[model samples]
Target: MGLRTDPVIFSVSVALTVLFVGASIVFTAPVDALFGTMSAWIITNLGWFYILGVTTFLIFLVWICFSRYGRLRLGRDQDRPEYSRLTWFAMLFAAGIGTILMFWGVAEPISHFANPPQNNVEPQSVPAAQQAMGYTLYHFGLHTWTIFCLPALCFAYFVYRRGLPMRVSSIFHPFLGDRIHGPLGRAIDILAVLGTVFGVAVSLGLGTLQINSGLTALFGVEFSKPVQVLLIAVTTALATTSVALGLDRGIKRLSDLNIALAVGLLLFVLATGSTLYLVRGSIEMVGVYLNWLVPLAFWNDTFGDTGWQGDWTVFYWAWTITWAPFVGIFIARISRGRTIREFVLGVLGLPTAFTLVWFSVFGLSAFDIELNGPGGLVQTVVVEEDIPGALFAFLDNFPFASVVSAVSVLIVIIFFTTSADSAALVVDMLSSRTQEGTTPVRQRVFWAVTSGVVAATLITATGRSGLDALSEVVTVIGLPFFAMGFLMMVALLRSLNDDTVPEAVHHLPTLRVHLPRRRMPRIPRIPRPADGEPAPGSPRWIIPRPGGPGTERPGPERDHSE
Candidate 1:
């Protein structure tokens, strides 16, 4: 129940941090630079993988949606607790979305606006800009969410129906069945745990990195990379500690705050910046998203400007696909009692809509800076500035610099915290046979702390390269699991009408003895109205009208008393 009960991840994290700190001291500056260079290179070379993978996923989504199995639901739990609408929305919008959404909400649209996709109209053109937002909607829409819903449905059904443990590996039940308790299952759990750790912790690192860069640019502070790391570690530690307190009090509260801050960030930029540009881009993004949605989902586009594709579109897809396992598990935890149709629609569509609003609002402000605002506001600050830093600078230029900066920092802290905490909770649920909230609070603390250490080590080893390596690992591992999940859902559908329950419980009648041996055909005969009367419900039934038992017509004019 206490930290002493479980120490694997915590011990590993400490050892990795010590090793990383030690290795850095003797390493040459050039070697360290090489590590950074390598991360960028990986992002470049493997970029196409994301594009191909996500495109394939998109095509699959359309196929599934149109297929007979698309609307399938798992298990027959007709009664379950339904989350209040507000709570459901808050949990998903805040805890479910990763830090990338927060980071890219503003920056992504701007990048597209600065250099719209090749096929897209010229940058800042009212038509082009708005269409770009549609791209945002398209990517985040059904294409992204279907995968998330699949696993969620898997978890809820297996947990409630079969009484299996709820881990990421739980999705493999149809194939693995009883083998889920073997080493292979453990391996799956470990990967999920590690992936989630790096994913959530690095988000904190990103936030602090941006905070340092923004403050240095805005308030003239010494924004050393080392200092940024320490700040990330410390800030993340605080949030993690809060998460240790438990979901109801800690994660949920922070999630609420994060959503508020997120909405506030978008609204402020929209109101104080250029409202007209944001509105125009939003409309355009929706159109672009819908029109190209199907085509982009499956389009290989290998020969068509692979370079640009590698950078923007491919990178984004890989990023999401990489995140599917972690997100899938988290989505599963909250998606209990949700129908497969509801799960797919809510997970995929709502997020897409939100992504559009975020990009449109934030990206348009960047357009103003690049086009009409300060001289270097758009290019210099954005292209010139680093990832998270760019958005902060954009905020600084607005009406209240201090207020925006403060809000930005708050959003980053809780956003990362909620992600990390919720992930830990999911891992706990999946790790053991118990449902979530049943895990000892102390056990949760261990997972959360260990995950932070894993992220810290990855950061120490290859900088953010660890995040990439971790992602690649999850994507590869999750593929087969996803396929197995697909099969299980299909099989489950076939058995929907059959009841394994005891007949006594299912309303089977009890008969002590048979009536005096009157043999009849195995099948029953149909009933008919009076000879001259037409059928009550004409043509509804295929059964022929019967004058005697099992006969379609009168049997040689039976006597009246027969």
Candidate 2:
């Protein structure tokens, strides 16, 4: 694989491990508490606003991408696709359907179905069954992708148009212009780098935890925490070294594995669980998604009575926005040869379709457990000690628990591995861009190492505490950045509307948005008193003709003075 031979990637990986272990001393509990409090506040209060704004913007963007920029392409319109349809779809699938989805697709709906969170101050009220579907669709639907689309659009324009490096600040290119290499630029890059680190590290950490649980459940391997961590570290090291071999080998293989495992797991669940309900839920949720689409799209409960709106609607938007920088950049890299409309549709809409089916299949499985099974998985996940216990509790009721366990382990391992490889690539992208066309290998090494160190530090510091704090930190940082990001998209969209302007203004490769010209509107003229009546003798309100002094356009002499 030529992986271990890559000195730069290998050295960076080792350095990351050493630095992270040292950094843990400063990762404190109070920091976690602070972030938790902040996260709760934002989710409770400002969540809906974020959701509404992001969703509205995305709907408009989809329209622009299709109606206005249908023929728009990015890298260069060519006959060959950026990637084979299969590879392309798999890449999108890999980027999104990670560890959380694997567990939550089944677990979350069950939790909500059993003891739906108290929608209001009422003592024992539960969300209605119908509201439950809406809630799931809400979290897994447009708003989630809405927040995600901002950075996708940003990265596309910046990478393709501005010729800047692939760092997050490249997003600000339409606004910041030449300053991208300056002090302000450095700050943007630093925050993005840190956020990306926190994101990947948290996922790795979570993946390891899940791996431990799955191994114990499926294979009776009860390693100590330290041993468990070592296994994870070793696994990560191996993956990173493979990444050093470059994108074509390690990352591609891992991502491919991730897709296969996830699909296999879903199919297994479908086979074992209630397939009828799974199919029904998918059809029903899809309909609910389209039917209440707008109300759900913008629903911000000033009153928290509807658990559906507040909990799922806003939180997913913020969460997706939080990941946009890293994920969007990754999407852009794989999207070079795709058209603007195709990229938007593939990245934004198609994923939603996949998610709807995926969640329904898994969710209905959980619901089936609650409705007919003996385990109280739906009733007890929140109180369960860990994610695996909760997920395992549900699986215990399935017909072949051992097979499900095996699939779960596979799902956890490959998903985490896929993410680690992709993250290595993303970090490299952030690090590599230098002054012009050449991407610096040293820069790539620096970021890859930086990511490892951050992950390690997060592990040592309050363990998962650093990750929890960092997720909140990411949300806080992304919010204001989103405002500016939105403005830039707006400007680009505006430029698309004006047919006389150059097509390059909107980042598309052609003049695709122009509409056929239409007749100008008619205007009325003022009557002097009556056509036959004597002229209203120079009425003080007398208006001038187009070429006269009284015209809206002043005389040339007055114009020159002004």
Best by TM-score: 2
Residue 376 deviation, candidate 1, in Å? 2.7
State TM-scores per candidate. Answer: 0.74, 0.78
Off by over 4 Å in 2: 1-24, 117-129, 305-315, 434-449, 494-562
lDDT of 2 at 394: 62
Scanning candidate 2 in windows of ten residues, the lowest lDDT window is 1-10
Best by lDDT: 2
Report the lDDT tens digits of candidate 2 across residue range 57-165: 7777788676756565654446336577667767756765466676566656655565554453221122344455566666766666656565766676566655567
TM-score for candidate 1: 0.74
- Cα lDDT of model 1 by residue, 114-198, tens digit: 6666564776666555655656555556656655555565566666556667665665666677776777766666555554554
Q: Rate residue 240 of model 2 by lDDT.
A: 64
